[model samples]
Target: MKKHIKTINGVDYLGHNALANNKIIHIKTTPSSSGKTHFYWNKGRAELIVGSKVHFPVPSIAHLERYRESFFDVGRNEIQIGDSIVWFFGKPIQPMVCATVVGARRDKGKRFLRLQPNHPDSIVPETWALYQPGNFFLVSNNRINRHRAPANIIYAAYQDELNKIEEIYAPIRTRRIILRYLTNGNLSMGEKAFKECHYELFKSIYSWAGQYRKIELVIGDRQFPTMHPSKVEKAMREFCQDFSNRYLRLVGNDRAKMLNALVYAHKELAWIHPFEDGNGRTMRLYLELVAKTRGYGFDLAASLNSKKKKRYYHFAVRKAVEGFPRILTALLNKALT
Candidate 1:
């Protein structure tokens, strides 16, 4: 279960592998004779159906049709894997909840999916009180309720809630655009390709979303070399040509060699700091594409889920900025296959 996701103001958005139809859901389940868990979808609760009939008002599988539809939004914009959904009940304690679509399946005439919750073990008994459309304004509200879901999604409710929510989900929308490129016949990987995706990620917010940064910037005490706004075009040209060279040079999976190549490309891109804010995120996406060149799934899930590893990732990237890329190479090597 490789997971690539991040939480903004407590809302989780999927930014990883293309798992179709993921969302946050609250349901009860019971042991069915088939050994797989039978989830109770109605009433926003579920329990394992133990015995055939134990005098409980067990809802029929027919009733589950409605609940299943609510939990998983089918037939709505081709629901890719990393997309997110929120279900809020307008309560204080645990008013709003979000989740991602992890996996999907089709049985008989129905479609089913596996949803990964955005909560942790600390809140094991997490319950989402789903808000109906009447109480909330979903981003998808005016856009047609094609998913047939029972819950209303509101990603942010804090200050500048709508804008913040858009920022949070930007990765999702951007990832979709990149996914299309990856799956499309056009197999180009270079600065322009990355810029297109970066633009999608930060388009609504930044005027220079897709373009290279002007002037210069620093990270803490480290002042990175950023191209002057005027020279960005030529620098990017050389950079992309060099990237293509390195990618073409990738050979049989000598793990260390492959990793070194991967680390070098990422290090070079980050050093360029191509775009202002989304350079890091877009680079992560580019690295995934690089890994794909060698049939590796460098998913964000196993990469960003750990506090310790995140620190190490930063450390490795810093090492890459210098000449010492062994750490970053080693980290990326571990993520392969």
Candidate 2:
């Protein structure tokens, strides 16, 4: 029989992986005076009124030991206090899907994974603390071992957003490395290349660079509920393989089809939002590859964020959600020609 999901005080923690999206609802497992053990998740993004039983550890898993392989490989290294992890929701028959690790709590020698707050870890990791709990509350990427905040940072409490610094051109350093790798001729631009590109672009900024986003997010008003974190890798791989195979083989004056393909490519990247950050810039970079193959270039408008243009861009992206690409096609058509 399948393993029963772990719970504290009869609260079902493992419902769906998406439930742990951006808030690492870190709960403390405690023993009560009546000789019973109960849980209180009164820290991090979700503060459960001290004695309420309303949360999960890694979401959808009653216990982590049942699927030992998925939690970490054999002889797992010291899982750093704040390192990101992929939690497996071992669905029967259906292939297992993953959730991002956001927080962790130690209970008798086991590091129970805490998922990224349904949202957190924005441009700055410091901003993520409010969404996470426990000693995993961090400084930049390193988890703070001290119970209190750093002496230098203001409001360095357990639940404050990190300070924002200038946009330090994280892209320039990453762009250089990716360009060198791409020009090597042996690499066919596909999902692997996309992964490589994402890694090179943001590894300097965050450790979990190439991996998929750990939580689900909405771009505009639409939630896109079905687009959960676990499905990110599969969707991206399929897209990369299919698009590369076709685009690479096409020859002759297929400009119309090529532009349409460009629209499709852009739409797919935006639709997925695969990486944590740089999805927009990454989409453009990927489009540039598609263009490079066709002996031309694709450029996203610098002023694309202006009210007039962002509205249309957002509308086109939303339309792509429903598989309608005419408006988006026109936009790409203009950029390519």
Candidate 3:
């Protein structure tokens, strides 16, 4: 039998091409299966099953090392040819491993492949590369890349404005308005009226609160000259129409269902880049509002601050362009849940 090595997190295991999932590669061991002798392919955890056969092009040792550093609690094991294993689960299984195969050790034994943790060939690797850059942008520039500095500044300013809004309203309702403002600044007339009514009711309590401040705006005219005012307006209208239509069709009045609905909607809206100034901020705000309405409130600022933000954004883009919502939806569910 040909021998191959497989790794997860940092740990290395041996397996062959028979282990790889047709849908995704980078498999993860289940938390419940920690320290267990047998491993399996897990979509949720990104693990490959022990004793699974995998086929891989040759991989370098450096590639193996890079893979382990990206994920936590890495391991490796081996598998033989002609072995069949479960790839994904319909329901959560205790002591079950759920991971995508990230890498495979190839050309080691005659006709055998090895699985490596954090494989560059894995989907998670591509997603992680995208995620990391987004993280760096947020940390260094306080926003995601591809936006003009002015837009980022405007977004920052709006966030400050939201803070002021909170001071003048009930915490719950204030949060809801902030969510709507972030998602779509121009709420429907009725929604706007509802927010204004709440604002009036609490004016006495927060009369001293000042107007939202402005950040120094940077223009993207030099970078994306085609993004003129007219183009922006068109984009916004399209975005609004799509969002409203989708919301009506898919979103339920309940909270949990709405949460899922918002996740999908946010992905679509982000792709639209409806606003000339603050789409990222808006999408997050939209998601937050949907969450709050459903009683599953979130602090998106904190979530966006994490390294995973890049992964989240990449997934969103992929879902928008490629029609693959699995990774994007999974990440959103993970974030909210």
Candidate 4:
């Protein structure tokens, strides 16, 4: 039988992964008798209140164990403070089980509560923290730790990259580039290869580059090439014109609307495969620019990968050909959110 966990009188504290149709879970905890609560996560520390829910997933047995140790694991199954309850599950536990009030303790100058159904006692503390949700472990596991850089080093690198772009470009465009770089690190150019290219120049004219070259571009696992050079040029021109017109209509001069327009416009442009080589890179960059213009920030590089790429590309194609923006919208929403 599969074991699942749930929490009562608590809020979700994090979101961990997007695998398996948004494989997400939550960290829910109760307040002290005085009604004070603490929030623990990798980014953006916040205060917890009654009735607040933060949903996230615990990815594996090891991750669950780590969470137990970090929060509770005070050499007991049940930990209580005031009127609140904290529970932990073991190897017999499954993703569906909700932990109840178990136990509490203080270690290394911090206080934590423990839950129940204790597994082996050999689980390490480092692994214990890996179980909390909200893209933290996956991002750290895949990129941060894989790169073997210290936390400060990683932050510095990201800040440096942001600074380089900010020095050379407008804030809006800089923000976009930052978002894209955060999401995916790779960038490609079709034929327009030059250093220090202005964001506007690339935005306005990159689609038309290499249009005269009679080549084909195919994405995902489709049986046919999605676009041929000759067809792409004509389609792109029409797409751009129509997109600009739509931008004016749907958003009607609102900056946020304009940014959303830009995202959709880039999505449409990507569908056209207007350039031979750099469509993917350009589309991502374009999306970043739009997002920055709208006061939104995201990390695309940290989210997408070779394993997820195939599904993403397939969704894009489906959006373009089937007149179904659901898949495309879902992807962009995921990125933006």
Which residue runs of candidate 2 sit more than 4 Å off their true CA positions? 1-178, 251-253, 302-305
- Model 4 collision count: 42
RMSD of 3: 18.8
In model 3, the runs with Cα more than 4 Å from the true position are 1-231, 253-256, 299-303, 308-312
- Quick one: ranking by lDDT, best first? 1, 2, 4, 3
Q: Candidate 4 — what's its lDDT?
A: 0.38
What TM-score does prediction 3 earn?
A: 0.34
For candidate 2, lDDT tens digit of each residue in 124-164? 22112212222332222222232321222122232122111
lDDT (C-alpha) at residue 92 in model 3: 30
Of the candidates shown, which would achieve the greatest TM-score relative to the real structure? 1
Separate clash counts for every candidate: 17, 17, 61, 42
Query: How does model 1 fare in lDDT?
Result: 0.50
Whichever of 1 and 4 has more TM-score, that candidate is 1
RMSD, one per candidate, in order:
16.4, 17.8, 18.8, 17.6
TM-scores vs. true structure, each candidate: 0.48, 0.48, 0.34, 0.35
